[model samples]
Target: MDDKSATFVVEGEGCEEDVLKWYYHGRSGRPNKNSGELSSKVKKYLSIKGWVFRYALKNGKKELQYQSPHGEVYNSLRMACKSYIDQGLGEGRMGNVDPKQPKKRKCLSIENQPLLKSVQSESPERRNKLKKQENRVVKTSKRVREGPVSSRNPRTVLSLLIDNNVVPMLGNVYYRNKTGPPLMKGRITRDGIQCHCCSKVFTLTAFEDHAGSTNHRPAANIILDDGTGRSLSDCQRQVSDSMKSTTTTLRTRSVVEIPKTVKAANSIRDENDGVCSACCGGGDLICCDYCPSSFHMKCIGLKEVPDGDWFCPYCCCGICGIGYVRDRSFRSCHQCELKFHGDCLNSKKPSEMKTEKNTLLLCSQNCERIFYGLQKLTGKPILVGNNLTWTLLTPDHRAHGGHGMKSSAKKENQCKLRAALEVMHECFEPSESVETGRDLIEDVIFGQVSKLKRLNFRGFYTVILEENGDLVSVATLRVYDNKVAEMPLVATRFKHRRRGMCRVLVDELEKNLVKLGVEKLVLPAVSTTLETWTNNFGFSCIPDDERSKLVQYSLLEFQGTITCQKLLK
Candidate 1:
């Protein structure tokens, strides 16, 4: 056989070496020895036809693999090259095939020579049309390889299907046999679907997936659309028009009789006299004695009608008379404006009254306690009777008769007095001067107690004895020649603070000083508590010049001290 006949026979058997030799010799008119050069040329031609050649290792041997864009891979390079040449020739891409090229006469006949020549000599317009046809074929092949193109948004598609009353299948519906029932019936949703035959609800994905098992069509899909010549667009337009008409009608309608409705309400209210002022006309109402207002007896917790008179809280005048009145006869609190009936006061409750002689009435226990507490904190008189007294003792006086005591009782009293005095000194004295003044006061008290039968220094003192015979507080009232009295010491036991003990002591001392013709009271002031004396007790701070003017009146020469004084008046 000739070279062309040998090539044709080798090509039929699909040999890579013979195919490469045929392709190279057909194009260059010379047999190519380099397999690499021949393979490169073949690859270039295949690429132009949208075929790709990839090199890979298979079973320890280097192999050339070919794939189409549609992902069809050829197992052999010879087969891929033969397929590519056959496709190119069938599409007239190799129409210019040389007539001199040798081929098997049976395959390349004279009848096919004219057709090939005509294709090679085709016009530009015909070639352009052919190119367009090839492009369309490529695109169609791509579409076939991929699935259908879904251009619409999923949500929009789903809504459209729902509005059209069409239940689109979510996925493929499977079956055990052609007539068998499906295992899974439907999809789950917030609101499930209802069955028509049994009048029950059933949610589903596809009718075919569940119809055989349930044997019932979905209620929503019972009405079949037999194409009455109406499309989904027509139904959508109808729904939109109805919605527009509803919104327009709502916008055009006017509010009805708003003013007349309000007027009717007011007239009904006037007919009822706007209800009771206190009870809103909910229960039995009584008119106020001093005003047009009325209140319910049940609302105020009143049991019976007042025998004398009745006044509402608004009608009462001033703080003394103002408060809810349950009875005909009531008394106002001396400390506050609240008034309560005489029967409301309980003897068991704490009273503001300092002594049994005090007759002031208080409305409640809280107000009474607060009143007494304020009096105690401010050092005012807390008692009214003459139960407490002031006595003066001299260093030379003897402990005998009514005032005399046994040595043991006297020693105990001295110790108690010393303890009380030390507590007072610590509270009133500055940190630096506490020890200095403490020793002096101790020496005076101890020296007198040790040397004499009775405290005999000619100094005035006031001591408050509790009901239990314990000293609650004490003070030294020093009377001067200039009609001024100085309170050198005033101290209460720590446990007795805020109990009016100090207040009683101060009151008794002042009364005695007034009897002695003392016109003013002077006392050393602490920087921290100076405001208590000035604001609560009406004492005023004396300036340096004014302090000197009163120096001759003060018996105790206070050095470098801030002093406050109060007039006896």
Candidate 2:
């Protein structure tokens, strides 16, 4: 790195506005990792500093207002953040504090350079081909050094937190009434948690109130999602536990994990499994970083141990196509079985991708399509029949709870889920469910359905029907590869059958199924209803020889049942 370096190359003497632009926009380094991700970064930084961004109507137009740690307000987000950054740097200067550096970068560094100097410098400092990194690092020390972040240093914590992923929901959002996390119910924005239960986004500086209001039960069964899956006593506890312990858990960058890995390496040995999953042999095998599965280098076609961390086929991040991550918690889509790291997520909103549509690409657009698409369909009602109505009930419905109408919303879902389960029980015996261990079908409806994998029950939705607001028909559906869908169970209450309620449910399902790229719908029809399915629904009986085409699916079948299929496309 020299004085003639390109990063600080100023072609022309930039005016005061340029200085301010660089001050707010320059680091493009710390907060605001990418062009559109600025709001996310700034939101997190301001949040940690007790500043909240709010909407205000000015001149009949909505504008964001930045409220300070105290009651003071700033109309400009950049200016307020700048003042705070300068204040942090000033405090660091007064105490002679040295912020922690995790690694030594070969690129040039910012040192002895203050923010004020960048703004105030008007000399002939201009150079050609100015190289400005988005997130440029400011050197507090003349030389790069690696050390632990000081717990007493607040600014050090700020930088560390800024570099890591600052997602709205720290943990997976859960609905107690729903079996799994809902796709559309609880939304996470960059700045606030869009709670599904209360249907409100609490983004004020007094975010403490959010935790407080949710702590107590609003209704007998309606428990508001506090954004956190677990219950803390109050909002203050939520803050201290979430952000205060920032020193230890989220302390350093990826470089800091090296020592921990090296220390663990000392005790590394062949896993207790003793045999390679790939070879069924043990000698000279490398273990997966994320799981007990081990493989011979040649078995997986790896030349040797070539990386910082080696994730097996199942443990890798889907986006970055890499193994190591700053944040250890890896997320996976139960549908696609691909893994993801929080840090690797582009976190691009739908609108952001619209403007940069040609440039930005995601790992799998279909997964996103299904995610957002299903999210949109969760509570939407589809009028499919002359006198009946159809609606898709995802875990999202359980999340919304009818906008805080006490336990009624939750109780209604429970009743519907129970009703659907009853309709299935009426048609399928315990034997029909493929050995329920002598337990009643309804008893195990809500239990973990993993064992029913052959049916692909993991990713599914309940499409139900109503005749004048009363539950009349139900079906459990799952789509795979968007090429095939299976409705394992469907039934209309004996009395509701004359009203074409089941027809409405199937019609609504097929409409959405076609939209999701599904071509065929498969289902198991019991002996008694085989004619009804084959003759009325235009479903052809699947011959035993051709049934193997659906082998990839775990289609639920009764002991005495005929497999049937209907082509949608």
Q: Among these predicted structures, which one has the highest TM-score? A: 2
Which regions in candidate 1 have their CA more than 4 angstroms from the true location?
1-416, 425-438, 444-462, 465-467, 553-560
lDDT string, candidate 2, 1-569, tens digits: 12121111112221122223334464454543353544444455456546666666776666667776676777775667566555652234223222222111111122222111131232223211111122222221112111122212211111222223332333223223334443223443323334556766433211234433332232121223554443211322333345436634543542365465543532223322222333233344455565544444554566545444556654566566676545667665544445567666555221112221232223355655655566567655666655356777643222322122233333334444555665554444333221122223333343224322321234566777864344567787766545567786676554444666677678778888788767889986655567988888889987755664444243444333467899996
Q: Which run of 10 residues does model 2 get worst, by summed lDDT?
A: 1-10
Question: Against the true structure, candidate 1 has what lDDT?
Answer: 0.39
Shift of residue 123 alpha carbon in model 1, Å: 99
After superposing candidate 2 on the true structure, give the runs of residues whose Cα lies further than 4 Å from its correct spot: 1-332, 336-363, 385-387, 395-408, 430-447, 543-546
TM-score of each: 0.27, 0.37
Estimate, for each residue in 143-214, the C-alpha lDDT of model 1 and write its tens digit. Answer: 000111111111121233343344333312122223544333333121232333443333322332345544
Q: Residue 28 of model 2: what lDDT?
A: 52
